[model samples]
Target: MAKIMLVDDAAFMRMMLKKALTESGYTDFVEAQDGAEAVKKYGEENPDLVIMDITMPNMDGLQALKKIRESDPDAKVVMCTAMGQEAMVVEAIKSGAKDFVVKPFNGERIVQTVSSILGK
Candidate 1:
């Protein structure tokens, strides 16, 4: 079981993601509401993977990505994005995100993305 960090500004999004992850046989995880919290939780929790939203308050995903990468060069981060954020996706990839998933939440694809990243 891979430990994951789910980071999104919306509580609903976090809940949905947690459900999907649980259904996919991922039992361990931590949650963060925004990039700042993500950075803090990541340092403490050291999850195996992170699913992050690009647009958030108190620091966006890209900045958090950079910070996490700086702290852990091998960090595995998958970005969650809304439509019309192609530029942000590209930037995230450049910043060391391993993959991306678009939302309003596709459960199967999210599971697949996580599985593929973890090579499961």
Candidate 2:
């Protein structure tokens, strides 16, 4: 049971992800609505993994990812992005994200990716 931090501006998206994570046996989750909050929460929560959206109010995911990576080089992050954000996605990877999930999330894929990252 790994703790996860979910960063997204959309409440519904967070809810959907929370449900999927719950169903997959991932119970601990910390929620942040924007990148600045994500960075703050990451420091306080120190979750096992992070699921962050690329587009967000305040700092945005890439910036948050950079901050987190600077704080902890081994931080495991997975971006939640919309379609056609390949450039941003590549930048995220370069900035130290472990992986990413596309928008209009697929429950099965989400579960699988998280599981794979957690080595479950």
Candidate 3:
């Protein structure tokens, strides 16, 4: 069982990702409402994967990814981005995100991304 962290400022977004991940047979999720919390939780929980929203308060996903990468070079992060955030997406990739999923993503796509990243 993989431990995953879900980071999003919106409670609804976190809930949606949680529901999708649960349905895809993933358990042990840790949720964060912002990038600051995401970094803290990453240290505490050390989740196998992090699914983080790009636009978050306190710190954006790119910053959090950078911080996490600095601490753990092998961190597996899957950034969540909305439409028209191409530059940020490129930055995320440069910052070391393993992959990304666009907003309005389907459950199947999320599952596929996670499974592929985790080699499940």
lDDT for residue 9 in candidate 2, whole number 0-100: 96
lDDT of 3 by residue, 1-120 (tens): 999999999999989999998998997999999999999999999999999999988999999999999999999999999999999999999899999999988888899999999999
Clashing pairs in 3: none
Candidate 3 global lDDT? 0.94
TM accuracy, model 2: 0.98
Provide the lowest-lDDT 10-residue window in model 1.
101-110
Cα-based lDDT for every prediction: 0.95, 0.94, 0.94
- In model 1, the runs with Cα more than 4 Å from the true position are none
Report lDDT (Cα) of residue 5, candidate 2.
92
Question: Which stretches of candidate 2 lie above 4 Å from their native place?
Answer: none
Worst 10 residues of 3 by lDDT: 104-113
Candidate 2's residue-wise lDDT over 1-120, tens digit each?
Answer: 899998999999999999998998889999999999999999999999999999998999999999999999999999999999999999999999999889988998999989999999
How much is the lDDT of residue 114 in candidate 2? 91
For candidate 1, the lDDT comes to: 0.95
